[model samples]
Structure formats: C-alpha cells, structure tokens
Target: MALRETDPPEVGGYRIEDRLGSGGMGVVYLARSASGRRLALKVVHAQYADDDEFRTRFRREVAAARQVSGAFTAPVVDADADAPRPWMATLYIPGEDLGTHVRRHGPLPLPKVRELAAGLAEALRDIHRAGMVHRDLKPANVMLAEDGPRVIDFGISRATEFAAQEVLTQTGRVMGTPPYMSPEQFSSPQDVGPAADVFSLGSVVAYAATGHGPFDSPSPYETAVRVVDGDAELDDVPPELLPFIRLCLEKHPKSRPTPDELLLLLRDGHVPEPRPLPTPAAEETRPVRRPKRRRRLWLATALGAALLTAVTATTVAVTGGDETAPGDLPTGWQAWHKSSKDPSVDKEPVGPSNPFNRCAATGRSLVCAGDDVMATRFALADGRNTWARPIDETADDLGASTGGTIIAAHSGRVYVYGADDRPIGHDGMSLTRYTVQALEAESGKVIWKTVTGDGPAASEPGTDSIAIPAGVVATYGDESQYYALLGADDGKVRWKRPLPDPDEQPCMLRGAAGHAYLICTLYTGSDITGTSVTQLAPTTGRPSWTVKAKGGDLDLVGQTDGRLVLVGWTGNHRTVTLINAKSHVLTTVRLSPAQPEEASVHLVDRTLYFILEGGSVRAVDPSTGRQLWKTDSTVERSSRPTASGTRLYLASPSGRLAAIDLRTGKVVATSPGRDDGTLLDTPSYVNAPPVLVGDALYVAYGRRSVYTVDVRDL
Candidate 1:
C-alpha cells in the first residue's frame, strides 16, 4: 500500500517508505533507521494525541511488547512513548498476516497448520513467561513469516503483576474479537491469564484449518454467546488435530493444557504427516478418504477426558525417571541426589511451599542450610551425608519462612548465622540476635562463634546476608549499624566500622580473591535515592575506593578484568558502567532499546551476560558497549547463569539445565527437567546460581532438591 500525501515524511527520525496498515489506534508504516535497519513504525492517529486514555494505552502497549522476545515474536526496536504523537517501531517482518493469507489462498494445509500451532505455542510461552497475557490473539495479529508464524500486536495485553487494574478496558466492555475471545474474557476480564491465550489459539487454528471460525456467527453478540456456551464447529478440522484443539478450547482454564505441554505433544509425531491436496480432476472422480483406524476410535471418547489422562500419564512418565545408564552419565562422574528434608523430623515435602534449602559448593563438599538445620555437609562423589547439626533457635514466622540462615563454605570452614532466640523492642518482635558460627567442614563442629547483631525483623525467603571469601567472613549488622569482617580461622573480628550513612541499606556484598566489595542503596522514604559502591581493604574494613551513583538504580554485578561492572536503569533505558578500580575512571555503555528492565546481570571474564525473564540471553562487551550475541534458551524464569570457559549454564525452577555457547549465544545441550509435582500460584524462586566446579554442575531447585550433572558429557 502506498503512503498518502498527507502522511508525515518521517517519524522520530525514521524515514517512512510505504503504508503497511492502519488500525483503530494508529498507522503502521515501513521505515528504516539511520543505521539502515528496517522497522515497522507505528504512529498514533492525530486525534488520539490529545486523549489521555489513548496515550496511556499506547504506552502500555510499548512496554508489554518490549517484555517479549522470541523466535516467533516480532522484537520492538525503538519507541517514543512521550512523543507528541506516540510511536513504536518493531523489526520489519516481510509477510502477510494469517487472516490476509487465508482470505487470499483459501485455508492452510494440514502441515502448515501444524507448523503454525508449534510456532504460536512457543510465542505464547515467551509472552506468558514475561508476565503478560496477549488478550487479543486473533488471526489478524499473526504474521506468517517464512520461518514460522509471528505473534504481534500487544495493544490489549495485560501484565500479570498489575492485572487488578484494567487500565485499558472500561467496566462491562468487551475487549477482544468476539470470535476468538475466551469465555473468561467476556465473563470476567480481570481474571485472564496465560490460559486465555490457549483458548484463543484453538479458535485461530480452527479458522486456519477450515477458513472460518469455530463459532462463526452473523453478529458479534451471537458470537460472544457461542464462545461461552455453544459447541465448536470442528467437523471440518483434521482428525489428528481435533483432540488437541478440543483440549485447548476447554471451558475451564485449568483443564486446558499448558503451552509447553502442547509443544511436546506436537513434536511427538502423534499428528500424522499432511497429505498433498488432490487435483480438481482427481477430486471429481476420487472416492473420499476415511480417518485412520487407530485414531478413529480414540476420537469417539470425549476429548477432554482423554486429554487429561494423556497429560497426567506423560507427566508421571517424565518425572518418574530416577535412574540412568552408566554410559549416559558424564565421564568420571555418577548421578546422585540427597534429600534436604529428614523424614523422621519434618512432615511436609521439602519444596517452595515449605522452607527453602540453600546450598553452596566448596572443594569436594556441598554445604546446605535449611529450617531447623544450621549446616550440613555432603560428599560430592556419592551424595552421602557427611554431617548435620540442629539449631535450637526458631526463625520468625511471618510467612512461609526459610529460616533466615546465611551460609558460606570455603577453606574447610562453614560460616552460618545462628539465631539467639531472644526477644527485643516493645513490639515483642524477636530481637533476632544472630551469632556467626564457623564450623569445621569435615565434622560440622563449631570451631568458634561470634555475636554479630540483630537480624532483619522479617527475613525474606531468598535473602542472604553474609559472604565468605579467602578465609574472611563479611557480615552487616542492622542494629549495630556497622560492617564487620571476621577471620574465618580464629573467628576474631579483624575490623568493624559504621556504614557510610545512618539510613543506608546494603544491597549487595561480593568477595573475590583478595578484595570484598559492598554496594549500599540510600533510601529517601520509600524510594531509592542513590547507591554507594565501596571496595574494602581485606582486613581493615576501610574503603580503598568509593563510587557514588545517583539518578538511577545501580547494582554491582562483579569485577571483570580489573574493572568494576555496574548496571543502572534510569527510566526506560539501561546502561552498563565500568569503573577502573585503580585509575578511578568510568566508561558507560548504553544498552540497545527495549532491553529487559529487570534482567539478571552476570559478569564472566570481560563479557557481561543478561538473562531476561523470558529466558533470552544477551551477551555484551562492557568496555565497548557492543552486544556480542543474543539467543533464546526456551526455559522460563531460569537462574542466574554461570560460565565455564565459553559455555554458560543455567537451571530453571523445573530443574531443567541448559548449556549455551557464549561465543554464539546458542544453547548446545539441555538435560531433561525434574518434576517434583509442586504447583504454586507463581513461579518458584531460584535459591542459588548454578555451581560449576571441575566436571560437576550442581543446581538447587528451590528447597525441594539439588541435582548434580557432569557437564563434560554435554
């Protein structure tokens, strides 16, 4: 489509070439950046610029689209949310939308439909992983690229965190295409989640297969009723796909299969290969074909019942594998597991719902701390329990607590925070006195104990307060208002000093070979005002150098190549700042547009790796501010990645481990995830980063279990 004479020549510096399309909210144009990168720039209609509600919706659409990046989703490149006429630009994909393609070339073939299903499932998985639900997933929003289908348009998407506030939709107003909207969207818009997308996927696939929606009606009002109450018109849908589609369209959200489940089913070859369409002459004389005998009877049973059994049976088979062949195990290593919970003492299963099991690896031993248990050592070779000790003091019971035990093991010594069990203050909130206990790594016997100070009143489940490096234990005392450094061998305080500010709080404390660094955030009321980074002298607790940062939230990731690497986010943009510890010089590199705001940053050597919420990994050079590579790992909500040479490893909450090649940012191998049958309302928290020592990769899956894998085989 050619551009109109009245259209602007450029938008936010992008040179507009031709008209792509126009929707209710804006006009999409094909444009190119100054760097010669092509983009689909969407400029708001002139009338919407003055409408506050339209501007807010446009801003949210930009944010929601930026949160998702996957193989089958268009990536947002740049945007000006505050512009006079708000606009967003995404990667220019050269393909027609699914609706246009079907209207021009009739319904898609079975093979094409199967491919569409797989691609759309992956896209939805990425969207849901980033805490969003694409409420308006219809055929028109899916572009049929050469590689696969790409889900686009987040205009009506809602972030799960802020779902309570229906910022875009008014009360009692339907917000999606009537034919594709889920029943929940019509009945209760505020309660939609990832399941809502699944229901819409069923309708889209049905329309592609038969060139008409499953619940097609002359009027949208009747279509809404059919979506909530009428039976789907799937008689024309392929038999191999009917059952899966039926499962997706289940009335209950819980009854519908997850995107991952759908992907697995699609990849298992259960759906037969699509046959080529018959010629017109052959069709005129050819007899009609019948459904395959094996699948014919299976379709007789209600799809909902059969799908439930199939899903349950598959889950059990996958999770029940407790043994593996010796040949399959890593070289010079055997698979091993040890229970964090003692059956004789505790009743509930050791998982996210109960207490969290925190573990660290040093040398040949693995140390773990949990509720009631101060510290326990296990041999890495065979997963045998070396020693265990019980602590008498109980943790504060505000929520599902993890017993606030901070443990670090190094140099044949385990450092832990032991509770004193004494109440303080007028409120009777436990004074939460903590004593740092140094235990022998081999015997679990306390070598020495030193009183630290009162701990936090309510310990958050995943917070760790101490760090041990090079035989030095570093702890922060809230009541004493000081930083303390104690000798690991003698348990004597080497030095103690008050924090820089009376109201400042420690955000991160990391220790390396000979130096320890502390980062403190200064809060003014409920908001953070600034951050302070101090490199402390090994034994004196004195600052060797201090860097103060304001105007953004700053975090010290770690030191790389004699430079301290820090990440900061001001508003919509993020930057990586590298400070030279010796020269005190700083170099700042602005990240690419649309980078994840809450990405987990890890510094490995000279390269910085960012793991986004949707499991996409981006490697950048801090010194030059150039992105080395970016790739999707396909694991949702994974842990902070650990690097071994050129390979980076990460583990998901589901216990799946992925190894990626850092040079190319590609996943080279992945192990089957362990399923503990633990279901939660939210994603499970990662207790610790993947521990890589020699040939073994130790991963803790929340409080439930710890897994040891031999990466040499991978």
Candidate 2:
C-alpha cells in the first residue's frame, strides 16, 4: 500500500512507511527504525534486481534472517543481501495472522488450541536450536502475539549449515503451504529436515483447532495427495488434542515429534487427557459443508466497489452524467488508449497474462476481468476494445478472477462474472459453473446467464452481486442460502427468499438506499458475538429492518439523510452510527483519534474517505466527526476511490495512477507502473478501479493494457 511511485523513499536506511505485503518473494515495507522502531522492510523485487537465482534466494534470506533471534521472534532488524533491491528489516510483528486470527475469530480455544500448541512448540524449539529448517510453518507463518506465538518467514528457511540444496529447492517450486506441507515437503525437498518443522507443527495445530487444513482438499493437487498420504483429518480434533495430533502427523521424517519432542509433549503434561466424545444427537448433527464464500474472496477482490456502495447499486453515475448529454463525455470522445490484447483481434494468451484487471461502468461500456484476463470490452469513448468472451479454459484452476467480471452495466444489460467448465456427467469430473451473465450492452449478445456459485467460488463469479431496482441482487443456496432477484432484462427470478444467515459468521451483502443490506457477523465461537443489520425486501426478500447490534463494528457506510450510515468503533472514539431508514432511530457521530483499524470507509461527496492501508486519504466529518484533510494516494494497493467533482480516481495493481485533490489533499497526478514483471505478478489482484468515462479516466494496464488519463490531465 501507498509507497509505490517506485518505492525507495528509503529502503536500507528504512523510511518507507506502508505496504507490508506483496509476495512471490518481494515488496513487504512499512518501514521506520531510525529510532522509531516499527520495521518489516523486505524489498527484493525490481524484477528480482538482476537475479543470480534471485540474488541467491535473497542471500539465503539474509543469512537465514540473521540466525532467528528469539523471544517468539520478529528479529533480524537489518539486512542487505548485497543491496540494489535486496533488503530485509523485520522486528515489526504486532499481531494478526494465525491465518488472520482464524479468519476473523472462529477456532482457537481448546485452551487456545492448547495454547497454540505450546507457542508453536516453543517457536519450533527456537528455529531448531538456531540451525533453521523452518521450511515454512503455515497459518501464514504464525504471528498472534500478546506476548506469544511468533514464528514469521525465513523465506524457505534452510540452514543446517546451508549447502546449496539445489538453490533451496526451486524446480517448478512448490515451497510450502499445501495445507501446511510436509511429506518431506512434498516427497523430499532436498531431504527436508527438523522433521519439516515438526510436520508444519502438525499442520499448524490442525489449523488452530479446525478452522480447516489437516490435509484439507478441494485442490492444491488434492492437498498434495492428502499430504503425501498421511491423510489425517482428525474429526473436529479435540479428543484431548487427538493423540498429540496423531503423533504430529507422522508419515516418516523419522515418524515425527521432535521440536524437542514437541516441547516435551507440550511441557510435561504428556498431552492426552480430557477425552469426551459422544455428542452428535440433534438428529445426528449437520452443518459442515464449509466454503462459505471465504469472505467472498475479500468481497470480490478488494471491496468490489464496497459491494456496490449504495443507490440502485450504481446505475453508472459517480459523476459520469447519467448518459452523455451534459459533460460525462461520449459522442465520439477523445483521449484514446487501447489493447485489451488485440493480437490481430484477441485469443493468444491462455495462461499467465492476468495482470489483475477488474472493471464496471455503463453509459459508455467498460467490462474487463483478470486472473488470465478475458471478459474484455473497453470503449468508454476512444479506447475501443469491442467484445471478447472465450477463456473458461477449464476455469484455469480457479485462482481468483478467472475471465469473468464485467460486473454491472445494468439497463442495456452487461453484468458478467461468467465461467462454465462443461461436462457435469463425465467420469472425469468438472463442475465449475458460476454464471450471472446478461450481456448485450451494445451487442456482446447473450442476454441471460444466471446460476451464481460453484466450487472455489469459480473465481469470484460476481460474489454477492447486488444492484436492485428490481434487477440484479444475488446469493444462491448451498450455504449462500438462497435470495435471488434477477430480471434486469429477463433472467427472471423476481425475488426468492431464505438468506438471512442466522449466525453465518462472515456475512455481508451491502447495497443501501436503493436497499439490500444483510451484514451478519455474530460468531459465538472465538467471539465477535453480535452485529446483524438485515434491511432486504426490494421486491420481497422481506426483512426491512432488523439491526441487532452489540458493542462495536457496525460498518454499512452509505444511505445517509434517509438514514443507515454505520462506521462504528465505540471505545476510544469513531462512531458515526445514524440508522433511521424509516425511524430505526440510532444517531451517534463521535470520531477522534481512531481511523486506521484497517481503514477503508469511503462515502465520498458527503465526505468521509478514510481509506488507509497505505494509500493514506482520511477526511472524515460524517456530519461532525470533523477531522477532514489528509492526503497521499500515490497509488499502491489502491483502487476504489473514484470520486468526480474535485477529483479523486486511483488504481495500482501495478497499473499505477492516482489523482486525489478533493479539496487540496493534493496528489493530483501520478502514473508509471507495470514495467513488465507485474511487480512479482500479483501486485494485489483484480484492482481495476479508476474507470470514470466522462472526462476520460479508464485506467488498467500491463498484461493487456487499457490506459486513458485526463481528469483534465490531473
């Protein structure tokens, strides 16, 4: 986030300040330390800065990240790996990981999963007595600190006196996270040792006590053939920690246990005791199919316009003149830029090219997609792309946005989020499905598709859609639990019901003053315990007022004046509540020093941006919470700003481009990105936001370009 206008505002001397995440070996940031601590750093990605085997695996991750310094780790506060892009830092660790606290609070409490299996078996017995071999201990490398479980990534840690190990196991690399690896890390990665970090700490303590992954499958080559055939699902685990996690998932590596005997069987209790069992009675208990859209993959790749920020869920008009008569362009408009890959008219790429696209616009079309990009159709004036459909390519192993997203054009149709995968009756299995189409926004043809979900969310086939003026709105059964709507131009469902989702934990549908709502979040396991919201009924899903609320985190953020705002924090100040979408009466407003709880708020035009996670922003004043001015949107992990009156736009998923001057928060222009290597290929998936269309903006780049720029050229 934030720092990327080609980063380096300080790297080896540490000053960067934002972006703690990027991957495929590079980008980390959130720097500091010239006596102001908070470090993290990382670097190494200027096209692998002239790789010599990625600078020898970043010089063996800065020499095994400086011998793993202890106290539950976040050590190595400085490194270089012969500079020029290679760097390191560390010591930042402030908690939130353990797979994002077991996916926003769910598992962990079998005494915190046996105290996270005795603080990750004493941080793998101090990185196996400092000689390394962490070989990636999952749950996103642990973290969870209130003075406890730390671990962290020594990038493919390997230092039993580090010999080459084939430049650290790199042939078509599968280095870690196949449900916490270990079957000698997929059948002997240079004979992985220290018992593969005690069998990835018995699959990260059975994914912190069952929030999944104990040879979990639905792909990863079937969890590496059930983690090399040791196949331990350990049914809801807790039969007193299932015989020391079935002797640390033993499938040889000298049949498991040593991180000093898994910390002496977790500090002398010898482990197995509190055995209970026999429950399953309420009609033989049911609930476990799982895949509850996994937060719809962060609401279809980064708040797909905050799940339609409200009002007929945007029938185009974030300033795009409700259809070309007075300003929002379109009558043979100018400022051109194209290439949604035109290799003599499309179809050459069938792989890698997904430079994370994503789009949505109407009154002058737009389209776009990602993950091996396809649903292409760009023409908000001179960028002429035209039609594109083809690429279901067996849904290319469903890894986020597989050729689908047009996601809403409305009246003259468009919609998208496709994917099909053919044969539902062959012995060779194939059920990807996904649909929601519509099309014909000036002839791409097909006017109705429908279906909605299928395995691996098919790659966000429009996850939790929404529009509704009697048209879009989605969700379908199999834990999406129903609710339909459809008919914008005849796919015809016209309202179905069910989907209130009693305690479904990670809920969220959103929309707002042209109504939809939903929200949910109550979770009794691992505590969140209250936050319902409801609202629905646009043509009969029928709740129209529910609320529930207890303690903090309410969130909706739009409807305003006709009521239903939301935002909330409550203790050290930041409320703004509101409600009354017809006398529901709430009110609040507080707001002081509490913005960044992973920011993102938004609102626009009635003020209250917030944003943060590095592209900065802030503003506030949701009617008297005041604050109002903070800048920097130099586009790094951006997308989702788009305003229009006094500018705002935004982009980056390596397409770069920012704008921002909504009243002097000045970054008025910035662009440069995608000098090829899409910054380690996924500079944050499916970004695609700056598509404005009237005073021309468009924005999307590399791996098949789009470009437009000219909010009066900033």
Candidate 3:
C-alpha cells in the first residue's frame, strides 16, 4: 500500500519509505535507519500514545521480541517504546504473510507445506527456549520468507514464568485468534505451556495446505466452541500430512508433541505410519461459562470485547500544581442533585427540537442556561442553584423559548442570548430581535448586549453562536449569512464577514479550538445536494480552508490532536470523517456492525464513543478506524460523554447520571433519576454534550435542575 498523506515522514531517525500495513495497535511502515539498513517500523497511533496500559504492552512486546533471536523469527532491530508515538523496528523479512499469499494464490503445495511446518517448529523451539510462548500463531502472523516462514508479532505473547497472564486467565477475559488457538489455551490459559505453540503450529500448517483451519467456523465464537469441543475438520488435508498434523492437535496438552519432537518427526521427507487419532475431550471437560455465555461468549479482539479490565476511576486533575491519589476528589466536593423550573411551570419539555438546559463551569461555580431560564449559577461544591435569571419579560415573542442557552463561560463572565423588547416592524407587526449579551458571573448584570442577526431563529444548539478559544462567534442574517467574532471581554466585534450560502440558505456557525467554522448545506426539495465545512480564521473572519462532502447530514462534533471529527448517519451505520486542520487530508470511517438508529457519538482524546438508544456503548479509535470495545448498559438516551482520566460522565433525559469506565467500557456507577422524574428541563439534544470540571461533573436535567457529581463518590 502507498503511504497515506497523513503518514508521518519519519520516526526516531528512521525515514519512512513505504506503507506496510496497520493493526489495532498502530501502523507499520517500511523504514530505513541512518546506515540504510532496511527495517519494518511499527508506530503506535496518536490516540494510544497517552494510554498508559497500551504503552506498557508495547514495552513488553519490545522486550519479548528482543529476547528471541533466530532466522525463523523476525528479530527486533531497534525500538523506542517511550516515544510520543511509541514504535519498534524489526528486520524486514521479504515476502508477504502466509495468509495473504494463500489469498492471492491457492493453498501451498505439499513440498512448501513441509518447509513451512519445519520452519515454524524451529521458530517455536527458539521462542520456547527464550522462556516465551507465542500465544497468537496464525497464517496472518507467519511470513513466507525466501528461506523459511518467519513468526512475528509477539504482542500477545507471554513468558512461561509470567504470573500476570495467570491472573487474567482466572477471569473470563480470553485473547488470541479463535480458529488458531489450542484447546488447552481456551480451557485453561493459566496452564498453557510451550505445547500450546505446537498445537497452533499444526493449525497454521493445516491452513497453509487447505486454505482453512481444522476448527474453522463462520463466527469466532463458533470456532472457539469447536476448538474446545475438539471438533477437527481435516478432510481437506493431504493423507501423508494428516497423521503429523493430528499428533500436534492432541486435545490434552500433555499428549500434544513438543516442538523438539515435531522437528524429529519432520527430519525425514516423509512421516512414519500414522498412530490412532487421539480421543477428543468429553463434554464435561468444557468450561462452565460456554452455554450461559452464548450472547457474547467468545473473548477476542474482534467485535468489540473489553480492551482491559475496569479499574477504579482516578481523579487526578490535568491542571498543573496540586495532585491527588487515585479516586481522590477535590476538597469539599460532594455529589448532589437539584432542579428548577421555567416561570410558567411547563408540564412537558419546552422544545421538541433541542434540549432545554446546558451548563459550563467558570471559577468556583457552574453557569447554566435553558429554554425557559436565561442564566443560572450552581455551586461547584454542591448542587445549589445559587442564583437564577429567567428570560426578560419582552412583549414580542422570543425564538425557540423564553430562556436563552449559555454559549460559554470564561474569565468570570457568562455569555448567553437575551431577548430585546418587542417592537413594531416596517410590516406593521411586532417583531423579536435577539441580543447576545456578556453578563458578570457574580451578578446577573449584562456587561454588553448587541442585536443578533434579525434572521430566522436557530432552534438547535450551536447553530447560531458558538464559543471559540478567543471569543464568541454569532451568526446572523437570512439568505446572505454573516458571522461576527466578538471579543471575550468587551463583547465588541473583532471581525465580521459573510458566510457562503450555497442555495441562498443560511449556514450554521460552530466553533472548535478557537477556530470558527461555517457548516453549509444545499438541498433540492427534500434531498441534500452538497455539504461543506469552511473554517474561518479566529483573528479575522476569513476562510482558512473548506472541505466538501457528498451531502449535508454530517455534523462537526469536535476536534482532537488538530484533526476535526465529523459524524453522519448512513443506513444503520455511522460515518466518521477525520480531517487534518492544516494538511486538509481526509480519512473516512464507516462504523462496522452497524449502529442503532438512535445511536449518538462523541469524540474526546482522539477516541470516538458511540452510544445506542438501548444503552450499548462502543469505543472506536478514530485514527485507525477500529472499534476498541462495546459494552451493554442501561444508561439509555444519555448525552454525549464528558471524558476525564479513564472515566466518561454522562446524563440521561430524566437526569440519570452514569460514570462509565473508559478502559473497560463498563458502567462504574450511576445516580438515580430525578426525584421528581421530569424530562421537561432536559430535552434529548444531541448537541448538548456533558461537561466535566476538575473532579466534579455538572449536568443539567429534570425541570431546570443542575447537579454536581464527584468522581470519587462514584
């Protein structure tokens, strides 16, 4: 494959020459050192760079591969597992992997299978002598070099003396490819020894000759079941090689021939007379979790299994200065829930299109806004609604609701929309003109208020105005759309410019990382013609760059590591687009296995978290376009997650709050729904993502209620 435009030019003095491939962990590149020695470099993805657990695994892999040295195994050449994007380089073996070779051509001939079998056995001997067991041995992991087949990718390997693998074995968390795994590996991983490699070698040899494994099945779970049940499918194997392969796949680990013994059997060109096939394990020997675990029985990398076991959430602040131990919350912080209401005491949710309440933290308290309430400050230490400010009583009708939404809060100032008095228009009718205001945080007094675009109302959150790192950008006007960048302190317009209107329709303005973007869509009747995101310069209202896509359904959710993340729905799947803010390089991803119709997505720390309406959550790596894990929970119809450390904070429409473990995709803890059990204040708005500050999580729910939940309590 060619190197992608987004691929790094070099890593740790190694110049990237070509693209090799990519896996769940990272991308592999064909690189060369200063001496021009060719090597294959594996660079970890940016998303996993900050992941402490993943870095530990990368270090272990580097150490394990460094210990083993043989012609049959790819030797570690150079490595720096501590680099920003951790990488390890190994000898560049010249041929394609056995799996790809077989896919391009047919199954290997008898002579080549013998060569493959002999080489792999020798590789196993070298690995075992180094006190390591290659847990994952499959055709894809075996390279058919000119000299022999070389075993590679020791990422999941373990030392015979390693007790860490033993601890994981006690739990139901199983790893390794199902069809290629040994029977003993599935039944008792803690008891796995060097013989497990011999069994996998047999499976790899069988696949080389027959283009399939002896325990192949449509689904990985079914394949795992077959392997555990000792159901071998060997009809396609050559008669001469059947006995040799059979001897290696003995159900009992003790019965399986060791790598040393396998080398003796293949010493000659032909095998001796076949011994009787070993008896299969009885049904009683199968693990007890098999039958009851049918829904998601197989524990493997594919189809979203948990990446790591859930650990207790940590509350270490990202801010510099003070630090705390794991699970320690900020001083005086307590989990509390409260609610308020619109002046009319509305019985149901005020807005059917967008959520009513939203919040942002400033200094020692949280400033919030909703459909009915203009602005309210909640104590950060508790859930007290310190002060509430309802929408001004204007004679003219306000757009969306009487209350304005909070655009942002910073430097002890809260930015929100306010309604100017109703005045008769030129058409002899009372008209409402919205005003954008900057209010002091201590008191509900406007510092400055300006008339917003006298155009159609923005019913959705972030459609009309959004806060950038510099200040707030408010969109106004109809047909000819215009946006102005207001100074954060003075509320004075820093710059004003017209936004493109493809079909004479207004474009939505959004902000991310101090950058302003104009989301434009052109439609013909009910069908969308085109969609594009044109980023505007923060200092000046000038177009920096614009990227166009097919249709307008996609939304600009967030940005991470200088890449913008846009999400859209297609059929039952969601398409995620990652674009480099500077390079303009685009990478599109289609979430596999499809998602529920009501599924929502959020991006944080370069990872995409998707939540289904029924509460199934999926964590996907946006860089690699792979789903890390999927977990089932009951935190239904929750808002987009506010990520901190290894936990995700979210709230449901009914004010139910859930703290999810980011590493394991498990629900750590959840607070009960509102005592009043009302959804009027918290409408189900996709744009109203949750907010996390320090060790406290502030969420708006129920009838005008804002709650503060401490991670330590969860």
Instruction: Point to the candidate with the largest lDDT.
Output: 3
- Number of backbone-clashing residue pairs for each candidate, in the order shown: 0, 1, 3
Q: For residues 156-269, what per-residue lDDT tens digits would candidate 3 score against the true structure?
A: 344222322211122323446778988667566667778788888889998998898876643333344346542355656776576567677766565666677677767743
lDDT of 2 by residue, 34-141 (tens): 899898777755665665666676677566657766677778867876777677777888879898888999788888887878788877777777777767788887
Q: With candidate 2 superimposed using the best TM-score fit, by how many Å does residue 202's alpha carbon deviate from the native? A: 23
Q: Could you tell me which residue pairs clash in candidate 3?
A: 339-705, 340-704, 469-514
Itemize residue pairs with steric clashes in candidate 1: none
Alpha-carbon local distance difference test for all models: 0.63, 0.61, 0.64
Better of 1 and 2 by TM-score: 1
Candidate 1 structure, TM-score to reference: 0.48
Name the lDDT value of residue 379 in candidate 3.
Answer: 65
Candidate 2 collision pairs = 1-19
Runs of candidate 1 with Cα error greater than 4 angstroms are 1-332, 343-358, 370-373, 389-400, 403-407, 420-429, 455-478, 502-513, 521-530, 550-552, 569-573, 679-681
Estimate the TM-score of every prediction. 0.48, 0.29, 0.51
Look at candidate 2 and tell me the lDDT of residue 263. 63
Least accurate 10 contiguous residues by lDDT in model 1: 311-320
